[model samples]
Target: MMWTKCLCLLWALSALCAPVNKQRQRMLLISFDGFRWDYDRDVDTPNLDQMAMDGVKAQYITPPYLTITSPTHFTLLTGLYVENHGVIHNMWFNTTTTEKKPYYQTLFVNEWWDNGSLPIWITAQRQGLKAGSLHFPGTSSSYQGEVAMVREVEPILYNYKNETAWRENSDKVMGWFRDQDLDFVSMYFGEPDGTGHRYGPDSPERQEMVKQVDRTVGYIRHLAETHGLTNSLNIIVTADHGMSNVYRNGLVEEITLSAIPGFSFRDIAFHLVDFGPSGMLLPKPGKLETVYSALKGAHPHLHVYKKEDMPEHLHFAKNDRILPIILWADPGYVINGYFPVQFHKGEHGFDNQEMDMKPFFRAAGPAFRKNLEVGPFESVNIYPLMCHILGIEPEVNDGHLNATRNMLVTSTGTRGENRSILQNTLTGIAAVAGFLAVVFVVVTSRQILKRKRKDKRSGSVQHLPEEENTKQTGF
Candidate 1:
């Protein structure tokens, strides 16, 4: 019971020191969903360009396999690959019941997100830091029975292309930082992805959305600066995956699984297709080999493999949630199970190795070096970098800090952040100790003065014994 009180005291102490930790440097991770690395290439983005000028920029960052939103964003949050994190797709499903939920509804499924890994929000909060998630994917779910101190989810049928709303979210998050004193935040923008899906990635609509995203970036910085966070905030802007133009109008070969002669949905117990270029199938008992044989070499654009024989580079087949048969198509084509139901001009979920599926990364703030563009790195490595910036020990993750270490300022090195944490903690402790000492001296002096006044009233005054610069405990 004594140990429990001690533990509680330590937790309270850490919470009381959050203001000091804020001075150590707060971290904000922003995700521009499906913002392709090259989207900014053709568009004139002065804000993004200025950000690159002031801080670190990467040529590109690779998302994990199954290059979709939820799984890839989960990778950013947990530093685990899609297979490891177990959020295999945007939608949650049960093969037995054939039940499924859309992306937004799936956000509330705690079991889906809390499989075995913890997002940085949970880890940060557990370590005595306050964190918030602003409409970020997986924000609605809790991990290990604990949720972020603060979080917001986008409303149903929320508009994803409103520049004004984007700025509002930016201002709101900055307010959380300044007023609520949050240590870390993960903010999300459902931009360019929606525009890219509505109009092809190369279309003018998508280009316009990129311009809006850049302006939003500038607005966020303006808020950060206005809130007096310029000296104490580290901001990382990245995305889940990139966008690609879908091949259509009958100009190119299409991959329709239902059209295959031997391939039959009747042969499969559960299947996921038409979501994008990727599809997964769990054949009925004893039908795995038959399904594999039927789908293999069925279409030149579609690549099918048994879960066990999936390529070693793609760490997607290990999880039990993954279906027995995996299928994906080349960049231009998308796989459809029953005719071409999808009509989006743009698509993702292609091979991560494909250039079109790669996302961009940019970071700025006191902790990051200026005007630096780093080489290519995987998005998985970002989790460790954020942990380093927040001075919190990261949970077991597949990411490595060395991948992004070169981007940090010399003063914000690995040791530098840890030292800052220790220094802030010691500073808090010292301030508390000094305050207690002052209280002790003041209380003691007050009692003595009261006794002296009473003695004077009685015509006798006694003095306190003077310590020779040492106390009972030898100073």
Candidate 2:
């Protein structure tokens, strides 16, 4: 009986710590780079609108601070802030080696990626599930010396030509799912981002690109239905960051480093410049104060900060890779260095708290709840939700499942309701065990009392034969 009680306690503990089963069979994660949160509102996105109506939609999803391409996208994959993930900026610069790798050049380098946090695809693969990547950043590189099973790291030039290119990529993604039998897959489309860069966000060209990407969305839906993967697969559509117009009255605001009076561009030991909205300035030996003073109040639109004095909310200043001085441009502004001034019509990599920097998030499939319009959430929380759907345990990350768990549904029920059911089950088991214990004590006491009463009644009158034998012995 003691062993039985111990067994019940052990069972309860096991129930509390049980592993989450795979939420669904397949997940297809798609990214539309620089697709603003409000783009669908301005343009006709019937397919996207229908998906929102049928599944879940977020009003907006805020990217992490330093809202750039590589950092935010990797944050979504790894669930870590830029300071922790080490993709501090789109471009890579090694302070120790004095090596500067351009933004596009770092795409193929393995060391530039492979931050300590594992992306979802790599996590799935490590857990014995097959995974694939189609031009998604960080997927090209190996994690802990292991790569995805099926990967296409071709340059972005090959993938984003026009509407046809998007459709072809969608077809290939579907093929990988159907023919290759992959459990997890990621795909990327460089759209409206490039278009917005060429033409301002409000321009007709950007609107047309929006429509083109919408068509691609519809085509992917058609393929999923045609191949009978609609119900079996969970499709997530999101973006790295949103685009903001940078041109005003036909003039671009370019902040040139050479224009600063006190600082010389030659004195800079390592300079990562020409990237819009944000750049890092490392001064030569004994020139830190001079560089900071030169750029601190030089421009009306540019905001400069010393590494240690950076805003606490940004979570950027703690890393060693961050240069001595950080420069940030206000919305609709640009930052430049010794390089020739070229104006892009639109730009990102600004303060993520701004509305213009927020991105779109929509998802549909068996795992997500239907007809739900969730409020805006941080992009870091996305990693945990993806891990939950894949049924793999997430690594140490800054995200919380509670932030997005309500958007998902499981076979048991909504995740929250399923948790409630488990809690109730454990409670009910405890209640039953407690009641049984009380009943055993009561029944045992009654039996003992009955025996005592019978003995007392017998002791009150001796048997006739026993009395006669006692009298004979006395005589």
Candidate 3:
């Protein structure tokens, strides 16, 4: 009876002292921007290839829209489409306003902060875990909850001339990774993306670019292994969208952002000058059909959707911020203005079976079941999958929860079924937990402030926000 009593006491003490859910493991999500699963004849990503051989490789991972950087990267982290996440295109749209928007009105930090999308890092932070992004899009500004973000300076890939800059920045990210004891780290590579933009998808130059990125990835992998972090690490390698060859001669007509009556241009994304990209059209009072018909008549090759007519699968609607018409350039064509823009071996962005289909996913780590081949999941599903591994809960994200059966081992551990439920539960729990944690931090901080104020009353100097350093004694 004494032994039993002692054991019970010890168990209770252990429960009180033990870390919160130490079963949670570490995760590393890396994106090789614009990287296609079939970049090389051999898909010469030896390290990545090995990861697939050892784990799971998704062949066709569709991106949200235009496959642009910001929205696509957002989808990767949040598992929502451009329509659902609100980062519809590379630019931001204000469907709320009735005033005519200027030709170049991009949403800055303040507006982006108000977006409804909840990045996974916010979920991780609430669960009392560390999260960091090396150069993921949407990190430059603040996100809800806690996250360590290195803002993206140049959001788009201009040309191959920026290759050196990309490498330098990537190395800096590696340095950051080395310096931190992070449980989750996201490192993004923009080489393939840049090469894809410049020389087109099938360019030998693009192939070479992937090789260069492969070297960097190899170095990162070596770093993980040498530091004994690989055992607990689950590496998720993916891309925003695939590249296509665009021939400048194929364009029919050019319409500048200035040409559109109410449309405004924000980001410098090349795809913005399409049949009519992601923004709302008010149609000058009752001229809605007239305006729509004129635009449609002008660009027959373009596909347009009334916000209400958008496919249910898209999970989009005629929201205030949504552009009335979404454009898809006819296959083998770009808009007219970019006609003289030199592009080799073009790729299409329309709903064509090929261009819309992005690369696959490859995950290797203890959290994943080995030798799994998930056919093709919507880009949005990545959010739940990520939430599952991190042991963080997320809301019922835009995409459905896909089972990772291929990656699971044959243990009767109930982990397989738990993944879906776990993601749903974790999302809600993390959200609530994060809010509570922030509240706790704020209250504690306030209490500390009151104590400091009391101390100051006894003639002690207290350091406050941006106040003079009176606490220092003339040092």
Identify the leading candidate in terms of TM-score: 1
Preferred candidate (TM-score higher): 1 or 3: 1
lDDT of 2 by residue, 153-270 (tens): 7664464746766777789989988898888898887777888888877888888888887888788888989988877788889999998888555475457778778879877888
Cα TM-score per model: 0.84, 0.82, 0.70
After superposing candidate 3 on the true structure, give the runs of residues whose Cα lies further than 4 Å from its correct spot. Answer: 1-24, 93-108, 145-179, 250-282, 297-300, 337-349, 352-356, 410-475
Q: Each model's number of backbone clashes?
A: 0, 0, 19
In model 2, the runs with Cα more than 4 Å from the true position are 1-23, 96-98, 248-253, 410-475
Q: Tell me, what's the RMSD of every candidate?
A: 10.6, 6.7, 16.5
- Tell me the tens digit of each residue's lDDT in model 3 across 1-475: 5445545655564444433322335777877777775774544778667777777887677776645666678877887666667765555544334333221233244355347767777767766667777666666556654345433434443343355665566555545545665677777765677667667777777777777776766666676676666667677888777766554443445333345454323222222343222333444445555555555645555566666777665555634556555555555555433323434344434451454346657787777776767787677777777776665777657766544444544431223335654566566555555655666677779889998888778874444632455445444
Per-residue lDDT, model 3, residue 160, is 32
**75 in model 3: Cα distance from truth in Å?**
1.4
- State the lDDT at 459 in candidate 3: 77
Positional deviation of 197 in candidate 1, in angstroms? 0.9
Q: In candidate 1, how many clashes are counted?
A: 0
Ordered by lDDT, highest first, the candidates read: 1, 2, 3
As a TM-score, model 2 comes out at: 0.82
